[model samples]
Target chain A: MRTALRLLGGQRFLVAPLCLLGAVIVFAASAPEFLTLGNVSNVGAQMWVLALLAVGQMFAIVTRGFDISVGAVAALSSTIAAHAVNALGPAGLLAGPLTGLLCGTLTGFLIGFLRLQPIVATLGMMIGVRGLALLVTGDGQVVPLHDADLASWLAFDPAFGLPPADWGAIGCILLAGALLGRAVLGRRLVMLGSNPDAAHLVGIDTARTQLRAYQLCGGFAGLAGVLVLLRAGTGLPTDGAGMELQSIAAALIGGTALSGGVARVFPVVLGAAFIQAVLTGLDLQGVSPFIAQIVVGLVIVAAGFLEFALRRFQGFAFHRRSWT
Target chain B: MTALALPLPVRSAWRRWRPGAAAWTTLGVFLLFAVLVPRFASSGNLVNVLRVAAILCVAACGQAIVLVLGGIEFSFGSSAALASVVGVLAVPWLGPAGGLAAGGAVVIAIGALNGALIAGFGLPPFVVTLGMLMAAAGAAASLVGGQPIDAPPSAAFAWPAAGSVATIPVPILLGAAAVTVLHALLSRSRLGRLWYLAGANPVAARLSGIAVGRVTFLGYLVAGAFCAVTAVVLTSRVGSGQPNLAPNLPFESIAACAIGGIPLAGGEGRAHQVVCGVLVIAMMNNAVVLLNFPIAAQQLVMAVVIIGAVLLQNAGSLPVMLRRALTRRPNA
Candidate 1:
């Protein structure tokens, strides 16, 4: 029991599961329909896009920076994918991730080699990508998929109690986990974020690591874009306007330190799930969507407070242990 | 030694008169627009450009204050929206003047709350402001049912936005006044120095007994006051309360500061820099409209200009690096 307590205390993402549990309990009690299998499945299906985006965001945040251009990049990728699909059949879906890779590469070059501030560089990319999305479709017209039936089948047809898209998202997330946890490049990213001077002294290529992190971030956003296309059966250039904030909120709530160098993929996915649950629960209760937004925002701040409290608690625990 | 000594005074003199990269860029954009776009150089169009820039400039003054304190405010857009909603709602009970005052108070109160949370709890300013942004926007939307509410037309209410004193538009005058006040606060006051010190190095400032927390709180509060002024003017101009009013205010203000060559890393900015940046953006926007470009081209052009302008600010190092590379090749 003491060992378990110690383990829980040491875990950075302890709050994510706790928060998720608390939300579920509160929602299940307040709304009788909250725990229904239909709603559960509905939320599970809906959360994959956010899950992918948040996982991607983890890469950037772990590098002590963030990319605010993900939503715009996703929208742009979706538009490109839509056009490609129309021209080359369903095989054209590859266009989305590729476009995202190209955009990410540009942003990475600016931030890495050119030495621009991450926020500023990403802000520029956000605007430029949004413009590109609009320009391609002739002033923000939605591009409908030619193969809507196939897209819907992949998005909604349940296989092994989960849609193909959800399975794909889970696969992508686990791959991200492996990359972040086991790969040398991931260690370099964390090391650079934790202490740039030390990383440089140890001969880590800080610039290249940052570039790779952003590339991963952009690539994930592209995958999210593709998911969006699959679900909506259309390319929406303006759809992801405020999604950047939501993804950041999810990553933060998942226990990714804003000060950098700490993250876990599973907890971050749980964070995204918590957000979806809140929105879904609030919707079940007939509350306005705006109120849900407010709750989500408050939850983000609460997450920050939780982190602060956890740090204080750990300090107190350390003192107690040392005294004993 | 003689050559170096001779150039010292000349360099100092040049520094004294030399416009910053932002200022020069503003001038160049202005000249380019004047030449390329017909009717852009007309006095009427110039006034229109300034008028449009006026609101952005006022809000950007608030943004500049927060940036100098090494913090960012994402709630300005939403807070302005909330203020407008409250202002219009209070109009039936409170007179127009009172309504406006109430609206200003709402913004100030929100600012004070943000200040208290950040100062008291040691919260990250970004997280706190972003939370406030969401909550405030939700409140605004809920109050008005996500629709715009029009205030009963009144001459007194319109005066703040429409009234001119001796051929000067009120917003322009207000914008200039805001710049002047910011200049005085940043350069002439003790609190301003504290802000700079705290922003540059908080631990050092704290160790020096500077009360960094209080300085930060006051900075955000002052920023709120500036935003309140903007909200009031915007409400008056539109003659209605809009839940989505000025949704881009925060981004635009931050962009203005960036374009003006104010480092986001904090510890340095000037009033003239803000004006120059605002003018550059305003002129670019005006030229885009005047050029009759497709709607999509506007955002594309804006994207290029923002990146290009920021790149230009850092261009001073490029030439030096190039020269170094050239010099080293011969030795190799």
Candidate 2:
């Protein structure tokens, strides 16, 4: 069992799956409706946005970075896209993606080229982008949307029994698997995260690789923004309010190292699903919402402990090496 | 030899202070705001800015120590909220002095717990403190049953925040006192030096026989105490325990420290960084209000400043700077 856990990339990676399984068992026993296919699809649909954000976050984490700004990116993109769609109709399809790309590029430049600390840099961007979002929306009111054909197609249109957004998330997950497991850029990013100095010495342009990682993160954030905006049927600036913490927690629980380098796409998606299940299960069980916050926080901390323990077991003396 | 020797004092002063890019930018912004903005240069407004900056300085000062030791605390704002709750609730039971003391102890204990988890278990400070931020915020919310706890208005209990000491506002005086004590701790105390060394190179510090774990643990304890001080001032000023008090403070405090030129990666920061950074933010916030710009603008500007300050402050040395200088080619 120990060797199996190690082979699956340590006990840390197993946490999200185990949590998901535990929630299923517990919730199925308590809430009879939880086992219903109808509720299962409902939970899956709800988890789509978080899963997308986690996938974006995974890219940054793989390169020894974190993008707290993704939430803001989502907010800004949705708001901006909402405005554009209101004015330009079908042409506004490009708005959300473009806005996300722009925000992602900016965050990329700060961390990759400018060498700013990822957390602080992205944090500043988070606040700044949110401010810009608020400024655009004016008076913090949610921008009401008129039902457009494009919006309906993307948001409400069922794609063989699921919304297009859910399909998008699944596609992104597959894309992430390909990117991290096979693509050269993804491989370079893992290398850079493993040891930036070594990667640089080996003729990799670390800055560009890191920049690409953030750009992808930002793009994914943008996609998430568009999907969420569609579902809500309006551009809510505060929509992504707690998402930054949620995505970070999901990434951590998914087994992405806070210290960076390891990135597995499927586990991250499962982690997001696991968190949603826990929250959904709690809600069904009539638990307080605040408990969800506490649980997310504790899970992240636990992930940290588990990661360190696993690393120690693997004979990686972190303090003696990189930290010092 | 004479000419080189002539610049020695000047060089030494710069090295000793090593005020990062943020300090210069603060001065530039001060001058700019004073010139372009109406009534910005007025004495009354400047004092008001300083007064506001004082509260931020309390938390930022504590955070600087953590940053210097290569850790970050996201819990200060939430901890302050919790402290405010504790202080206001305890005031009726324990009176003013005892209430503040009780509140102070809770905040300090929160910090110590964070320290023990981090230092003892080798857990990442980011995750540990992020968790604490969540738990603390939740606890504060749950304590008042999601309502703000109001303290009965009393002059004696509230004097530490509302009243002045020798013409200075109590909050301002308290802030100044905190800064002074922290400055002394960082510059004059052995523990401060140990913190710097540990932050710079923990393994080296451990090999050198420094108790890196204990020092780190204590550093967090001090940070917690500072958070309590800020909480007391906030609670007393408002005459209430506000669970929502200072929600944005953690980021703002960090931004202030960054503006003061504290490297986010840690190892080198000081009390002055907190002061300078807070002043800049205070001034900028004042500018937004005075200019009739939306509050959102202030956040946007702070965000830009954080990125700009970090970029300029940590861009490596002279030769590297010259290499990237606009008019030059890489191999030229």
Kindly report the docking quality category of candidate 1. acceptable
Clashing pairs in 2: none
Candidates' TM-scores?
A: 0.94, 0.92
Candidate 2 CAPRI assessment class: medium
iRMS of every model, one decimal? 7.0, 4.1
Chain B TM-score for all candidates, comma-separated? 0.92, 0.89
The list of candidate 2 runs beyond 4 A from truth reads: A1-7, A148-153, A317-324, B1-22, B314-332
lDDT of 1 by residue, A34-116 (tens): 99999988888999999999998899888878888999999999999999999999889899889888888888867765667
- Candidate 2 docks with a DockQ of 0.50
Expressed as tens digits, the lDDT of each residue in B30-114 for candidate 1 is 8888888999999999999998888889888888888887777888999999999999999989989889889989988888888
